[model samples]
Each structure stands twice: as structure tokens, then as C-alpha cells.
Target: MAEDIEPLPVPRRIDFDFPDDIDPNWKADDPEFCAMVNGASLTMPYLEPFLIKTVRETARHIDDPRVQEEAKAFNTQEQFHYRAHRRFNELIKAKGYPELAGLEARMEAAYARLSTRSLRTRMAYTAGFEAMTMGVTRWLINNRVQLFGGSDTRVASFILWHFVEEAEHKCVAFDVYQAAYGGSLGGYFARARGVFHGALDVMFNSMRGYKIILRKAGLWGQLRSRLRLARRLGSFAWTVAPYLLRAALPGHTPRREREPQWVHDWIAQYPHAPEGYIPLLDTHSPTMPVPFPSARAATGAAA
Candidate 1:
């Protein structure tokens, strides 16, 4: 039953170390994938604050106490996440891609403009964006081994932790939308439109950041880089397509997308993890066991 239940979006104050010379390719061997993921990371500082503002404002329209509480918790979790990503994103910029500043500015301006839109429109965008997260979170966790293997521990753990919270609070935004709009047909269409608009908008900006960063890295025009990105994007689409499709349909709630085992383990284990640095995922270990308190203790001892 514990496994069946998701914890609230509890705020974790774990620390991550990102030194001056840290490799932006925390993936170690996968720079192309790094570009894509880091590009997504670059959007977080701007995008998430936009989300927090929109969700918070809409919370006033809903009478459900649980929904309101969830909204607050979700915003708290996002505050921590964006701050962590903002810290790491600084490393990405310092590593070389000054042009990323331009991308960030553009996103900041765009989100500011989006902020002026009606509450329903903003809420719909959030619901749609969050709806896509069910698939995105699954994709990240499903490929954790392949993606984070031998990667920098601090980064790998930080990213996984963020997504774990994402999985935990999976229903908050969608529920907020439902609470605000009730079950109206027009609301359904708005949500459907948001699925496309929100997902495409984020991805478009992310890839633009990717191009700028990769061009600076001298990988943007390389034949191998292009091919790899294409294949990975194709695979990501194939993996997440059904989840996105379902989210756009009527009567679809996030609960229909089951949380993966890792999501459960992460929530179960985090409470016991010693209160300091979040334990790094043991990249060298074949099993990549959940970072339980005892495991964290052992890893700290061995280090």
C-alpha cells in the first residue's frame, strides 16, 4: 500500500556540488545527449518560476483544500528544483556557451508575456505541460542507467531526485486545472491545445538553447551529432507518444500513468537519507541500488 501511495511534494534541502571546472557533460561519454538534457535544464529557471506564478494565482479560484495544499507543495518543490538547476546551468554557461544567456533572456521575456494571459489560459498551459511530465519522468527513470552511467554523481543524483518529486506531485497541476474549469467541453479543448502548445514551446526553446550551446562546442554541424540527436529524439517520441496522447483525451487523469518502481523507492528512501548532501547514485555499482540511509552511510564511508 505504501508503494501504491505517493508522498506529498515534500521539500528536500540536500546539497549538490558543482565546481568551477565541472564538465557540463555529466553524462561523461555522451555529449550529444548532454546537449539535449542540459538544454532542457537551461529552461528550468525561467520556465518553472512561470509555472509557480501561474499555479499559485489559479489556486485562489479553487475551493478544494487538498488541491490548494498540493499546489503550495508543488510550488515549494519547484522552487528547490529550479534553484538547483540554476546552479548547474551556471556551470553550463561558464563551461563555454555564453550565447545561452541570449536564450535565457528570450525565455524570460516570453514567460513574462505569458504571465499577462488570462488565468484559464495560463492554467491550461500548466496542466498540459505537467501532463507531459508523466511521460518525461518515465523516460528519464526508464533510461537512468544508460543516461547516467558513469556520470558525475552529484549531477546524476540531483536530476533523479528532481524528477522523483515530479513523479510524486504528478497530479497537482492537472487537478488544479480540473478544479478551476470543472468538466466543461471548452476546458477539455483548452487542455488539449495546451498539450501541444506547452510541450512544443518548451522543446522549441530547449533545442534552440541546444543549438547555441552545441555550436559553441563545435558539435552542432557535425554529421554524427546530427544523426545521434535525430535517433534519440525519435526514440523519445516513440516512448512518450502514448502517454501524451492519453493526457490529451477526455476523462484522463495523471493517476492512469503508474509510477515506476524507482519513483516509489526514491520516496521511501529519501526520508532516511542523512541530512546533508544527497547521496550520489553509485555509478560504478551495477545494481544502482536505492540510496537508502544505510547505503548513503556506506558510500560516504567508502569515499
Candidate 2:
């Protein structure tokens, strides 16, 4: 008989408050930068639903009470993230980026196909996706200034808050999958396929978004700008490579270095602190000013 697995500890919910003082001229002044932000913002809706679904589905297989608790917390945090990003996406659309709408439609179709897989497969894929997110989070933390340019405190703060939670919950999905599947070969294969597919999805979508933003800003006039951005991103991808490699290796050791004291201190004083706070949005309908699905209801359905 299979031994019963123990549950992991539940994490706390996180809250995000949009900064009220962002420069209105920021987007128009730098179209290329705006495009990058918009592209990232556009990804929230599609990715959030997947996260919500994965947590909900995996909760059933989590026999351990601690793990189940953590899954619940994870669901809440992901919901907060989804809603916040949706708000950011609204700002992007307001800036005349109509391409984002089409992108959302494409992602919806893609996720609909993915939703048909078995629970085990979905769990494996979620683990893989989380691993990749961990890699990206670390890279962003290390290169925040370059990624956002200097002096844009709001955007920098927003991304940092997101990545910190992403880093904290990095292992939840993988641990949950292993517990449910007994570490079988099929489970590993499913995870690997998920990682590959998720990476490709992000890359293609990001490229299209970047191109659109650049063309709109008339920044496409300089061939060097395009090459420069691509090369920079390529370098950043290399930085994330080691994390992905380690994640793929058997019996990999998880990295849990604490955030620098200065960085932590900086984030601690915000209206929406990032470490352990989970923010509740004022509304849930698609017509809301900041449209998003209900985190509580979505996760509750899984439980």
C-alpha cells in the first residue's frame, strides 16, 4: 500500500495596492518601455486562470493537511496577483495597445486546450510553470534597474512584490505533484513537457508584444534598438538558465536565500506590503474598474 503523504504548511495571502503617483507621461515618453510593461501585464489573465485551476485541482490529491492549507493560501496569493495584473492591463489598453485584446483571445484558446488534460498532468505542468516563474523572478530581481530603466519606482516596486511571492511559493506545485503521483516517471515527463510549452508560450507572446509596441512608438526606425532589446533579453534568459537546469536535475536542492535586508526593508513600508499580505479587490465582475475573477470563490471550488 502507498504511504500517506504529509501536507505542506499553508502560506499567508498577499495584497497589492496600485501606486497612485506614477507619472502619466511615462508611457508616451518611452513607447518601447511601455510595450515591455504592457506585454508583461497582458499575460496576467491567461496565466492566472491556469494557476487558479491547478491549485484547485491539486487540492483534492493533497492528503496532508499542511499541504492542503498551503494550497489554499497559494490560491489566494495567485488570485491577488491576477487581479493586480488585470488592473495593470487595463492601464495598458487605455494607452492604445489594442493588440492586447487579440493576445488575450489567443491565450484563452491555448489554455482551453490545456484544461482537457488529466489532473496528474495538470499538476505536473503547474510544477514546471512554477519552476520557470522562479527563474524569471530571480532574474528580474537581479536586473531590476536595467529591466525597468532608472527612476520608475512604481513599476519596479510592483514587479518586485510579485516576484517575491513567486519565489516564496516556488516549490508548492512541485511538492504537491510529487506527493500525489508517488514520483513516477510519467509525472516527471509531464512536468518537463509543461516547462517547455510554457516557456515557448511566453517567448512567442512577448516577442509579438515587443514588436507591436516598437512599431507603434516609431522606435523601429533604428535597427539597433530591436537588436539591442533582443540581445539584452537573451542575456537575461541565460541568467535564468542555471535555475532551470537545477530544477530539471534529480534530487535538486532548493535555494532559499533571504532577500537582502535593505530590499526587504524597502518593501516593508508600502501601502501594500509584499511579503505576507494578500489584498482583496473591491470588485469581482468583468465590468469592474479592475476586472478579475474571485480568488476566494475560485479556490473554494477546488477545496
Q: Pick by lDDT: which candidate is best?
A: 1
Alpha carbon deviation, residue 76, candidate 2 (Å): 0.7
Q: List the residue pairs that clash in candidate 1.
A: none
Cα lDDT of model 1 by residue, 219-252, tens digit = 8889998898888788778777788789888878
**Residue 224 lDDT (model 1):** 93
- Candidate 2 per-residue lDDT, tens place, 269-291, comes to 33334445433222222211111
Clashes of each: 0, 12
lDDT of all predictions: 0.82, 0.61
Error of 1 at 258 (Å): 0.7
Segments in model 2 whose C-alpha atoms lie over 4 Å from true places: 1-34, 253-303
* Clash count (model 1, backbone only): 0
Instruction: Give the candidate number with the greatest TM-score.
Output: 1
